[model samples]
Target chain A: MRSVATNSTARPDAIDERILEELRMEPRATSKALGLKLSMTEVAVASRIRAMEAKGILRVVAQLEFRAAGYNILALIDVMVADRKINEVAEALSRIDRVGSVTMMLGDPPIIVQVQAADSADLHDLIVNHIAMIPGVEQVETNLIIDIAKWRTGSAQLHPTSLPG
Target chain B: MLVDDVDLAIVKELQKNGRSSNREVARVLGVSEGTIRQRLKKLEAAKAMRLGLVTDATALGQTAAAYVRIKARPRHARAIAAKIADFPSCSFVGLTVGRFDIVAFISATSRDELVRVVDAEIAVMEGVLQLDVREPVGYAKHRFDLIHIP
Candidate 1:
């Protein structure tokens, strides 16, 4: 799987930002249509998009409602592992199908993960049979995601690529 | 919102490529173009799904991603998450169990920016007893792509 880089100082230019915004608004629009909106040639827009995607700079994803998918349980697992085996434990957890997002957190609980299960029984099975069994786990704390009351996606707004003066 | 079989098929197709034309989808599904159009319209209106171009913030320049664990009064957790969700830089905020009452997933252009978000915005929330910040180098699956066609 290609990993989209989440760390870099490189920023998109104004044209690229406009392209991103346009696509964000109309993800289903054809490149030809996007070109018309930007007043830039279709070839320029298409190539730029292709290049951005190849470099993980541009990503288009469709999100479905998880509850509708029968994944009623969503959670965040904060794990404290043996001092030197953080990556080892994280890597092992990532291999599990249920574990979604795994990252090395910078503080007390050095690792954090997002997991989903069919129901409470499955949640228990995962923790008891899967997570707790992982070697080097100094401690494992599971937090149920009570509600995703509000979630605003941060896209095309980080590290603003200041418009040229 | 358990979608019907046809709806699941449409989502399956869109999951593969959100940009698939309605006509093309209809043709592939052995249905009229109008049917595909109507179904898509319903999905859009109901907000059952979203089609958009998303990117890794790191690819656009600012690189750090962190999860802020907030210890607070239980009643205020959801309210606090909603407030943090209003922050433009915040991508996700949720009320969680265990070590923290709430978790806010926010990204920054740099280390300094991350710190400011933790200090100025999150730490100051009313009823918050304490806050913990943890940054992950990468995510194995940072997505909302899961589905159940039943």
Candidate 2:
């Protein structure tokens, strides 16, 4: 998989923003369809998409609603780790298939992760056997997400100004 | 809403490249384009899957991000989470069970904006008992895929 451009200072332009808006509405719209709607050639539209994707501005991806996908539980785990061992514990936790995201924070529980499990027993085992067993991990606090009021992908959050009316 | 092997296969293909045409995915998976199309429609209609753009916020200059955990009064967690979800700065707002009643992920263009949202907007809300903010210094992994269904 190609790595996202992290250091690029590029931002999407007006035309690019329009393309993004169209995609946001119809994520699978063909380039030909988009070009006709946007009054640009198919090639031009596709090229702009490629450019923005290369700049790490955006790329289409499939997002799952975990509950419907057979995952019964979603939880955030806050892990307090030994001093100077945050990165080590984080890397280990990230390797777990059940751990969806691992972020090293700047506080007491230096590592936080989003995790999913098939059920309560699965979640219990995951924490006790996988996460808590990681070296340097002192304490683990599990915050089971009961209901999601709102959740947006990073792309949606970044371009709120271009939201469709 | 039962997810079969075919549904998982289709989702896996789209997870890799959401823009992959039905014909392309069918060709790769050795299934008919109509089957692929039909499964995608079903999965989407079931709200089991979403095809959308995912971006790197750091590359776009929205570098400041933090996770705010809120302790809410009894029976107010859901309402507080709903209100917090409306904030432009919060990308995620959920009612959780643990030390905190609600948890939100806030992203802003700068650290000042992040702090302002946490202080002036979130902390001052009614029913808020306690609030803790944790800023991520680094990310070991942040996969968009929730889990490997297969």
Candidate whose lDDT is highest? 2
The CAPRI class of candidate 2 is medium
- The 0-to-1 C-alpha lDDT of every candidate, in the order given, reads 0.72, 0.80
lDDT of 2 by residue, B1-150 (tens): 567898888888887778999999999999999999898888878777878777667546688999999999977777788888888777788888888889999999999999999889888888999998889887787766542221
lDDT of 2 by residue, A32-99 (tens): 99999999999989888887876667878777777766788889998888744778888888788888
- Highest-TM-score candidate: 2
| Native contact fraction (fnat) of model 2 | 0.70
Tens-digit lDDT string for candidate 1 (B8-106): 888777766667788888878899989888987787666666776766476676676677879999777777888998787787778877778888888
Clash pairs (backbone) in predicted model 1: A6-B58, A106-B134, A106-B135
lDDT of 1 by residue, A1-165 (tens): 323344444457788889888887787778899999999888888787776765557655556666665678988888889855787887787777777667776556777877888899999898788987888877888889877755534353322221111
